[model samples]
Structure formats: structure tokens, C-alpha cells
Target chain A: AQTVTQSQPEMSVQEAETVTLSCTYDTSESNYYLFWYKQPPSRQMILVIRQEAYKQQNATENRFSVNFQKAAKSFSLKISDSQLGDTAMYFCAFPSGGSNYKLTFGKGTLLTVNP
Target chain B: DAGITQSPRYKITETGRQVTLMCHQTWSHSYMFWYRQDLGHGLRLIYYSAAADITDKGEVPDGYVVSRSKTENFPLTLESATRSQTSVYFCASSEAQMNTEAFFGQGTRLTVV
Candidate 1:
């Protein structure tokens, strides 16, 4: 079974500052995909960024980036220049192995950007 | 308008009653999934379908039923609703490939009293 864990339940960051959300997973698969999703007050789930396990280089999408450590099974998200709009619940997810491709997610980290 | 959608954004039902949540996608993706979001549980997969008639149980599928008669629709049903089942439900779809990203709907907030 694959399980994702987000150790931080809640986090806060100041405007223009940077914040990093920690995430770890237990997976035996050698190659896979990891994703971060943001859910705001509108109840819409938005994709933040993604990282492939086989690639050693980190994935960066504008201000959103991921530090994926395959050997340790650690995938953490870093948000640079945090803005008020970045305040939301962030989830880390990965598809399970097999044909179903079911996504297993972490508990999520509630992030608040204070002005 | 060419994305996934979930009907009855908010629903209230009595215990032991049956309620079905509808999901539809226009992309004709090969995989559809149902997930429940709770305060400390993020999103737990209840059911998922690989194709029109290929459905499988997920981590938490005890009191839920799902059907995928069509390629674009996957509906989740609760035969006997309970207060414990009150949570935000999300519907998502993805391509057949393993590394593709999953597109999510706005989610349905279901309350069982």
C-alpha cells in the first residue's frame, strides 16, 4: 500500500516571504508521479505542481517548486513570494501502482499568507 | 465547459436513506474516481473506474456504491447514509496513462443527518 504523509497540519507565511510544506510517502514503486493540489474557499481543487520520480532535477512552476528526494521518499513543496491568494489547503498525492491508477493523498497542510 | 462536473453541489439527506451523487466528464477519459475530503483525511478514495464497466474499491469503500455504465459518467451511491458519511465529495478524471494528471471537479458537500 502507498501512503502519503504531511507532517504540518497548519502553516503561516508573511507576504513576499517563502514557505515550504513538508511531505513524505511510502512507496515501493521505482518510478511514479507526485502532485500538489490547492483547494481554496471556493471548494475548487487546483493543481499546483508535479514531479516525476525518475528525474533527479526538481520541478518548478513559476513560484511553485518541489524538492523530490527519491531515495528517502520525500517530496516537499516550496512556495516563493507568498501572496494572500496562496492561502489554502495544499495536498500531496500520488497514483497507486497497477491499472486502476487511483490517487492516494496526504492529510493536507492548511497554509495562510498573512499580509 | 469542456471538463469534469459534479451535480448537487450540496445535498442533505436523512440517515438510512439512499443518495446518489452524479459525475460527468467531457474529455472521455479512461479513469474516473470518487474521493471524500475530511478535516484530517485530506482526500480518501472511495471508488474508481478504469473503464465503462471496470470498477474497483479503494481505501475506504465500506458504505458506498458506484456505477460507470457510460464512459463519461460515474455515479456514487450511498445505500444507507449515516452522520459519519457527512463530508465533501470530489470527482476526478484522468487519462489512461499512469503519469498523467487528474482533473478535479468542484466537489459536492453531502450531509447525512
Candidate 2:
């Protein structure tokens, strides 16, 4: 079974500063998909960004971007100019990728953006 | 109003009791999923449905039951609740196409005592 791992359980950054959350996965397939999801303290979850393994270029969404290293099996999320609203639990996910497109998520990293 | 939603945002039940979690999506997506979120285990899949009358078990489907007679409704049931089954449950839906984006609903925090 494939698994996603987020090493940092908690992280923090000052408002307007930048922060990076680390994630890794174990997969043998050359082409796949990876994703970053944010769950606000209010409990509403949203998709931050997604990356396709087949693409060499990384994916970026506004102030959010991903550092995807296909070889190292690492996919890290970088938040630039973080806002107080950015304080939430971020999760990394991967698709099962065969017949079932089920998503397997990692233990989230709690992020706090100080004002 | 046109998105996925889960009922009983918070639930408390006793062991050996049967409880059901309701998930409804307005999108009528072809795929719907039920996942349980735990402290260290992340979100483990409990069950999924490809369409009405098409359901499949996921990684953690042992104590849970699911049915999808309608494309817009997918309900998860716990035949016999246990303390270990207490966790935040999330319901998500996506299009039939692979690699498409999946949207999640506000989770249901279930507590079994």
C-alpha cells in the first residue's frame, strides 16, 4: 500500500513571512499525482494545489507553490507572504492511481501564522 | 448550495449501538468517498461508491457500512460503534475522470463512548 508522510506535526511563521511544509511518499510508478490540502480551524477543507508526476514543472497557485522532487519522492508545499488566514492544518495526499482513484492523505501539519 | 455536505456535524453514540453518517452531494458526481481522520493515521478511506448501486470497500472498512442507492447520496453506517472508531469523518466527491479534483465536506466528529 502507498502512504503519504508529513514529518512536521506543527509549524509556524510570522505574517508576511514564508514557510515550507515537508511531505514524502513511497511509490514505484513513474507517473502519478500529488496534492496539498488545507483544513481551516473552522473545519472546512480546501485544495491548495496539485502536481502531476509526469510533469517536470512544479505547480503553483498564487502564493502557494509546490517543490516536487520526483526522484526523491518528496513533495513540499511553500507558502509565500503568509497571512493569518493561512494558519490551518495542511495535508498531503496521493491517489491510489489504478482502478480506484481513492486519495490517501498524510497526518496533517498544523500551521500558525502570527500577526 | 451546490456542493457536498455531511449531516450530524457532531455525533455521540454508545458502544454496540448502530449509527449512520449521511453524505449528500449536489453535484451528482460519479464518485463519492468516506474517510476517517485520526491523530496519527491521517485520512483513511472507509468506503467509496462509483455510482448508484456501485460501492467498494476502502482501507479501513472493517466496522463501517455504506450504501449509495442514489447518485447524490452516500451514507455510512456503523453496525456496532467502538471507542476506537471515534474520529472525524469526511465525505468527498469527484468526477469520474481520473486525476480530477475532489471536493470535501465539513467533517463529522464522531465520539463513541
Candidate 3:
């Protein structure tokens, strides 16, 4: 079984600043995928970024990036130039490759971008 | 619109009543998933289907049932609603390609009183 952990329950960042949300997971499988999803008050789950366990380079998408450390079993999300729209509940998820396509998600980190 | 959609955006049901949540996708994805979102728990997978007529249980499968009679539709049913079953449910679909992203629906908010 794979478990994702997000130590921070809540986080706040000033507008135009940068913020990093921490995530760690436990999985015995060597091949897998890590993802960060954002859910706003609208209750829609949106994919932020994704990282392949085999890739050494981190994944970056616009202002969102991931620091994927396969050895440490850590995958953190960094939001640069944070804006009010970035204020949402961020969740770290793990999807096991192979026969299982189910996703294991962390509790989530509520991020508030204050102006 | 090449996306997934969930019906009955909001539902209210009494205890012991049967309720069904509908999920449909236009992408013709090979995989469909059902998940529940709660306050403390971010998201938990309830059930998933690889293709039509092939379904599997996920982390939290109790008190819930799902079926994929068609390629684009996956419906989740609560045989007997309970207060503990009150939560937001989300439907997602993904292709068979490796590392493919899963598209999510707006979600359905269910309240069992």
C-alpha cells in the first residue's frame, strides 16, 4: 500500500511571492507517478503538475513546479509568483503504474494567498 | 466539450434511501474512477473501471457500489444512505497511455440526513 503525507495542514503566502508545499510518500513499487492537484471553492479538482519516478529532472508547468526526490521519497510542489487564484486546497497524490490506476492522496494543504 | 461531467450537482437524501450519482465522459477514456472527498480526508478512491463491464474496488468501497455498463458512463450507487456517507464525490477518467493525466468532473455534493 502507498500512503501520501502532507505535514502542513495550512499555508499562507503573500501575493507575488513564492511558496513550497511539502509531500512525502511510502511505496514499494519502483515505477509510479506523483501528482499535485488543486481544488478551489468551486470543488473542481485540477491537475497542477506531475512527476515520473524515473525522471531525474523535476517537472515545471507555468508557475507550478515539483521537486521530485526519488531516493528520499519526497515530492514537493513550488508555486512561484503566487496569485489570488492560487489560493486553494492542494493535495499530493500517488498513482501506481501497472494493473492499478487508483490514486492515493494526502490530507491536503490549504494555501491562502494574501494581498 | 472533451471532458467529464457529473450529474445532480447537489443531492439530499434521507437515511436508508437509495441514491445514485451519475458520471459521464466524452473522451471515451479507458479508465473511470469514483472518489469521495471529505474535510479531513482529501480524496479516497471508492471504485474504478478499466473498461466497460470491468470494475474493481478501491481503498474505500464499503457502503457503495459502481457499474460501467457503457464505455462513457460510470454510475455509483448507495444502496442504503447513511449519515457517514454524506460527502462530495468526484469522477475522473484517463487514457491507457502511461503517465496520462486524469480529467476530473465538477463533483457532486451529497447530504444524507
Candidate 4:
């Protein structure tokens, strides 16, 4: 079984400030994919970033990046120049390699961006 | 219209009653999944379908029923809705292969009284 864990329950960051959300997972599979999802007040799940297990270089999408340490089984999301809209619940998820593509998600961290 | 959609964004029902949630996707993705999100539990998979008529139980499959009659539609049913079953339901779809990105729907907020 694969499980994802987000240690931080809540975090507050000033507008335009940087914030990092921590995530860790337990999986025996060597090949998999990690993802970060954002759910705002509207309750829509939005993809923030994704990292492939084989890729040594972290994934970056504009101001969103990841610090992926495969050895330690850690994947953290870093949001730079964060805005008020970034305030939401962030979830770390992974899909173990297989045919079903089942996704396991973390409990999530409630992020609040204060202006 | 072009993306995945779940019907009755918000629904309220009584306990022990049977309720069904509808999900449809236009992407024709080979993989479709149903997940439940609660306050403490972020998101847990309930059921998933690899293709039309090929469904499998997920982590929390108890007290739930699912059917995939067509490639575009996958409906989930609760034979006897309980207060514990009250949570947000999400429908997602992805292309071939588990490594591909999965697209999530807006989610259905179901409340069992």
C-alpha cells in the first residue's frame, strides 16, 4: 500500500512571500509520479505541479516548483511570490506505476496568504 | 462542456436512503476514478474504471456501488447513506497509462441527514 503524508496542518504566508509545503510518502515501487493539487474556497481541485520519479531535476511551473528527494522519499512544493489567490488547501498525491493508476493523497495543508 | 462534469453539485438526503451521483467526461480518457474528500482525509479513492465496463474497488469501497455502462458515464450509488458517508465526491479522468495527469471535476457535495 502507498500512503502520502503532509506534516504541516496549517501555514500562513504574507502576500508575495514564499512558502514551502512539505510532503512525504511510503511506497515500495521504484517508479511512480508525484503531484501537488490545490483546492480553493470554491472546492475545485487544481493541479499545481508534478514530478516524475526518474527525473533528477525538479519540476517547475512558473512560480511553483518542487524539491524532490527520491532517496529520502520527500517531495516538497515551493510557491514563490505567492498571491492571495494561492490561499487554499494543498494536497500531495502520487500514482503508483500500474494499469489502474490509483492515486493516493495526503491529508493536505491549509495555506492562508495574508495581505 | 468539454471537460469532466458531475451532476447535482450539492445534494441532501436522509440516512438509509439510496442516492446516486452522476459523472460524465468528454475527453474519452481510458481511466476514470471516483474519490471522496472529508475534513481530515484529503481524498480517498472509492472506485475506478480502466475502460468501459472495467471497474475496480478502491481504498474505501464499502457501502458503495458503481457502474460504468458507457465510456463517458460512471455513476456511484450508496445503498444506504449514513452520516459518515456525507462528504465531497470528486470524479477524475486520465489518458492511457497511470503516469499521465488526471483531470478532476468540480466535485459533488453530498450530505446525509
Report the C-alpha lDDT of model 1 over B35-75, residue by residue, as the tens digit: 99999888999999999999999989999999999999999
* Interface RMSD values, listed in order for every candidate: 1.2, 1.5, 1.5, 1.4
How many pairs of residues in model 4 come into backbone collision?
0
Which CAPRI category fits model 3? medium
Best by TM-score: 1
lDDT scores for all predictions? Answer: 0.93, 0.91, 0.93, 0.92
Considering just the first chain, candidate 3 attains a TM-score of: 0.97
The residue pairs found clashing in candidate 1 are none
TM-score of chain B of each: 0.98, 0.97, 0.97, 0.96
B9-74: candidate 3 lDDT, tens digit per residue: 999999999999999999999999999999888899999999999999998999999999999999
The top-ranked prediction according to DockQ is 1
DockQ scores of all models, one per candidate: 0.76, 0.67, 0.70, 0.73
Candidate 1 per-residue lDDT, tens place, A1-115, comes to 8999999999999999999999999988888899999999898989899888988999999999998989889999999999999999999998876765788899999999999
Q: Which ten contiguous residues of candidate 1 chain A have the minimum total lDDT?
A: A94-103
lDDT of 2 at A21: 100
lDDT of 3 by residue, A4-103 (tens): 9999999999999999999999999988889899998888889899898998999999999999989899999999999999999999988876877677
